[model samples]
Target: MINSVLMLLIASALSSSALAKSCPEVLDSTQRKLNAVEQVNLCDEFQGKVLLVVNTASQCGFTGQFEQLEQLHKKYQDQGFAVVGFPSNDFNQDRGSEEKTAKVCYLDFGVTFPMMARSSIKGAKANPVFTEIARQSGVVPRWNFYKYVIDREGNVVGTFASSTSPVSQDITSVIENNL
Candidate 1:
């Protein structure tokens, strides 16, 4: 009877371990920050927070959106929301070097939110986080500044095109509703 009880306890412990390791597919990968050696795992860092994941290019016409994105990030961050930017050269507009990209994001825009290293955000070579996002949302970024809103549960709840303002009522409503 003691042996049976011991085996049951071990099984329960293993089950809990498995469950703990089950991060959502969309947030399971680690990404290096732009111009930094530090990396972060999306699931570990931003799980249970509403996220605005954007593909950015420093030279795009929509580059000015960084200010608005920063606004949204600041306003809602205390409410468990964050704007995560991924610098992508998929559309041929990103500043070529990481130093230039970092300057655009950090110096020019005063962006405080996480800005990931430059990576492909569309097509076959898209990063794992973006690939999973596209898979779940049924939308792929056609241009720089495309936005994906993910709920605290790590589900893609909304996809906004490049023309959509980060602080528009459409995006804000979803964020407010989720929070």
Candidate 2:
């Protein structure tokens, strides 16, 4: 009887441990500020799908990535991929409020994907998600438009430098494989 009880207890503990899911090695928290951008639940946003989280700016040199990002979203959105854009003034690359920034993204790039609140994307005050992405991928952005690819299972699959174009074969291949 004692052995049976112990076995049952062990089994229960093991199952509980196995059921606890971990988020991607990148971006940390689901709770964060939502100002100009839409307030989003990361878990719900990417549930059962691959997500491309990019730190964006309105005035930065890499801003053109936004156009390519839109194209990627258009290409893969129907196939289980999403591009989550987070505007940041962390590097002073973004210069306006969320609505103000959205105007620029809309008029300049015609973005259709989700836009997130403005937050610091680097250093001590960086958004939890971006911080975790930097830690997991080991490729912190040197500038804006740095892209982090989250696999369908929510793992940090790759980190592209700010200069890495969204249309590059490397990024497209990942999208192709996952989608």
Candidate 3:
């Protein structure tokens, strides 16, 4: 009986170690949904999916990209792809409050993809997800709507400027190739 118990413990430790190694550091974060109490762990929610991560602002010129982003998300979601938005006021363009931000994203733009609560996207205070993304991609958000495309394994495969359209060939190509 003692030998059997020891073997069970060894198997459990090995399983946990394998799980920890498979989850990328970039996805090792839990974030609240915009204006919602529920939180999602990135690894648990998005592991093995191709992800388009964008830092967004409600009042920015690129806010309209939310529409195309939603389209992208819908088009590829069944194929293990997703578009995740992080609303930010770091550039002073986001709505004044989370309520307003949620309105703009859900009511105005009809954003169906996951949108995280407002957070810092640049400098020292950037959230853990973005900080790790920037570290892995060697790029940072210069303005609202900057995007990073991550592969299923959580490696940043592409970095896009705020000017790039969500449906642009450049962005779509990377997503398609990775997916």
Candidate 4:
């Protein structure tokens, strides 16, 4: 009986560890803030929510979309949805420094959604999240503010180009359907 109990306890422990490791490796990585010391562990923090991941640049023509994105975040956030921004200089449009990027995003744009550190969003140097996103959507970001819509299960269900408005019906429909 003692040996059986010990075996059961070992199995239970192993199963728990396995469950914890079940999140997709592509989504399990940690993302740092653009200016702050804050970090977000993607899988641990946002596993069950619909994610709208956008590659952003402070000086891009689409910069005004930040306000619309924030509005979308607020509209659906209470229903298990979130918007994540990744500041990138892949197009040389950003402020060129984390501090300035933070200022543009947080202060100038009044963005309240999470903004990730500067990362390459295209080609081989792209961040893992973007790489996986592109892989799933078959669409590499053509410019800043490219949006990838991910479902609650971490699957990329749609890729919206820079021209697609954040408040467009297509985006909200996808988010609502996922929710």
Best by TM-score: 1
Give per-residue CA lDDT, model 4, range 56-145, as digits (tens).
999999999999999999998999999999999998899667998899889998999889899999898889999888887789998999
TM-score of each: 0.91, 0.81, 0.90, 0.88
The global C-alpha lDDT for each of the candidates, from Candidate 1 onward, is 0.94, 0.78, 0.95, 0.89
> What range of 10 consecutive residues in model 2 has the weakest lDDT sum?
31-40
**lDDT value, residue 46 of candidate 4:** 85
Tens digits of lDDT, candidate 3, 68-99: 99999999999999999999999999958899
Superior candidate under lDDT, 2 versus 3: 3
Which candidate achieves the best lDDT against the true structure? 3
Error of 2 at 32 (Å): 6.5
**TM-score, prediction 2:** 0.81
**Per-residue error at 102 for model 4, in Å?**
0.8
Model 3, residue 111: distance off in Å is 0.7
Of 2 and 3, the candidate ahead on TM-score is: 3
Backbone clashes (count) for model 4: 0
Residue 23's C-alpha lDDT in candidate 2? 49
Tens-place lDDT per residue, model 2, 107-168, is: 77898887777887778987788777777777777778888888877678878888889989
Q: Per-prediction count of colliding residue pairs?
A: 0, 3, 0, 0
For model 3, the stretches where C-alpha displacement exceeds 4 angstroms are 1-21
Candidate 1 residue lDDT tens string, 28-85: 8999999999989888899889999999999999999999999999999999999999
Clash list (residue pairs), candidate 3? none
Give Cα distance to truth, residue 108, candidate 4, Å: 1.2
